[model samples]
Target: MSLRTVARDDLKNAARSYVVLGVVGVFAALVALVFVSERNIYPDPYRTLFDVSFMTFLVFPLFVAPLSYLAVAGDRESGVVKYVLGLPNSRLSYVLGKFASRASVTLGAVVVALLVGFVVALATFENAPNLGRFATFAGVSALYGVSLTGLFVGVSAATRRRSRAMLGVFGAYFLLVPFWFGFLPIVNIGTVLDAVATTFGTTVTESTRSFVNALSPATAYLYATEPVYSGVTDQYPQLAGTFGGESSRIEAQLWFNVLTMAAWGALGLLAGYASFRRSELG
Candidate 1:
């Protein structure tokens, strides 16, 4: 079969899987809650929906890791991938096909959840939802989820053991990425040096903590969506203005967030393909 056909078949198979269905349900429920609760706080449905959805996706990896960690690792462990490879498919085609299928599934789930949010907003609030803004949010949120899925799938493909692959992806999401954010404060040697310089009546330098925050995909997603979520009400004052256009040191440029997420997905797929190409199944 052609690679496109292979990809289509993979998509169908994933759509039927219980795990995929379960993830979709969880996302829909979360989005629904966000919509139902925020209606009372924000004056407009669009703003309420946008705020909750965008904030929920800030840690998008947490939602994506479980579904993607077993994308290839489970098949590889069960020896099913070997037979599939024997069916006139190159390793690269297989890898690409799986990536396409998983990304599609991730995107579909996000759209459904967004739709649930939209419905909830319509039912609860008197103000009309902004279809245009909601559409934009859905597209960006799906892109973020797919990017995270690719990263986890790559980690899964690289590992021989299914348990290791699963644990590794979870670790990368819960530990490594968070560490990237947390370690910045702990190791702000530059800031410390600047303080020392100030004590000496010398020029003080600024630290690159913002650049470090932008390095995390979660932070990048949050920064990119900040432009669209206006009218954050007083209910959650702390979360208000989160989506404002004001660029701080930690906020990545809008273009940078898009590029960083795309780069992350591409790099992860490439790494997985390379590893799959070289490794022996037996």
Candidate 2:
């Protein structure tokens, strides 16, 4: 089997799953809801799109997790991997195929939902939506989804059991998504950094905080695409202050954050493929 064949088969299988259908439905509904409900509140079409992007930033990881976490580990656990490997396909093709298939499913959902939201914004909003900015937001959002799908698919490829893959994927989601920015009270990077700063008799500067926050894929996505949304900084007063009226610094630069997000996806694929290539099928 070729890589395309494997990817095609996987996509077909995923399309048949009720879980996948439910996920796509819920994701589209949420995006549409944001566009409809916030039309009156955020009169400007760009701001409305920004709000939709922010919502996706928070929830896209969860949406992509289940779709990808079972890519390979589930087959391995069920002994189907043996049969798969027995085909003319190499492990590399198998892993890449899984990644491609899952990424396609994810990107497809995002594009459709965003398109629907764009139509809603056009029809209901007073101000006209900027096509260039809207397209840029969609492009950045799609890149973010692919990055996440790669990461989760990597976890699936690296692990041999379904439980391990699920744990690793969601554990990553909690750490990098919600908990990273102190959205949860349990424990967060911000709290830890504060304690470390106090113990070391130092303060966390704006640049330091921004740098740390950018380490999360979600934050990286936002910063990477902030240029498209001109008033993004105004929406986040703290971030505006953090940039200190200038965003030319290395950490604050859009390229750096874009690299950060891209690195996560690239490194994840490399690491997982290395592990998957060496593991015994039996």
Candidate 3:
């Protein structure tokens, strides 16, 4: 029917996800900070930043991803799909409402956590990251969150079986997201090299530089992680010895991740909306 009516319902459902994710994120962050501080092994700002951002971006998203599965399945389970489908609005509108409402909530929480994490990190760390780098890092993280949430929503919309949908969501996370996070670091050597090349008086090769620019997500993590933690790798060689420059230039790779994540997220939203519209809700 009307957007107002749809929004009201969407808001109610989204609250559940926010409450659950918020509690888990806060508790986990506190525990992690305490545990790391106890070790007293030379404070690593990059690690700390990773701990904080991972909790906010990766960990929390893991839990909230399940919400996408439940949204449509829950409606179907309750037998309300028939009535809702019969409303004056097109299914597209209804689906978009769900996506807009829930995604907004998830996106907001992530943005807040990252900002707060940066502030806390800066105050705590002796070496504060530059503001420009920090902004780029946050943008990349947001795109990642969007991609994570959007895909799950799409999968959920496409399935009638709740368990199947969640499994699909989580399965993709374990298999693909990690590969992107861990391995992509290798290719993202540009920024890391750029910083280090100055010392060597020899710049990384252009092809190798492009690989780093196209693949690495490390810089994204580095920028956000710097104030929060230490040991965040800013760069790496694209390959073992194929003329890929030193890792220092890899920090530049974060922008590639930012754009890629945004592209996936946009696709996910489109898929979710389309699937939701086609869904009979029967």
Q: Tell me, by TM-score, which candidate is best.
A: 2
Per-residue alpha-carbon lDDT of model 1 for 119-206, expressed as tens digits? 8887888787878778877877877888788888888888888899888888777543656545466544345555777899986433
| Candidate 1: segments with Cα more than 4 A from true spot | 183-207, 230-251
Ranking according to lDDT, highest score first: 2, 1, 3
Give model 3's TM-score versus the native structure: 0.63
Cα-lDDT of candidate 1: 0.73
* Alpha carbon lDDT of each predicted model: 0.73, 0.85, 0.55
Per-residue lDDT tens digits for candidate 3, residues 1-282, read 865677578777667665646744664455346334623432434444444454544465565575555666566667776688787976666666666666666656556655655565566665563565456445655556656666666766666777777787776665444543444554423445766887889888876665544442322442323332112343322111222334455443444455655555567667766776766665
Model 1 / residue 164 / CA error / Å: 1.1
lDDT, model 2, position 92: 91
List the candidate numbers ranked by TM-score, top first: 2, 1, 3
Task: Tell me how far the alpha carbon of residue 129 in candidate 2 is from the true structure, in angstroms, after superposition.
Answer: 1.7
Candidate 2: stretches off by over 4 Å: 195-204, 231-244
The model with the greater TM-score, 1 or 3, is 1
For TM-score, candidate 2 versus 3, the one ahead is 2
User: Residue 77: error of model 3 in Å?
Assistant: 2.7
Give every collision pair in model 1.
210-250, 226-243
| Least well predicted 10-residue stretch by lDDT in candidate 2 | 236-245
Candidate 2 has a TM-score of 0.91
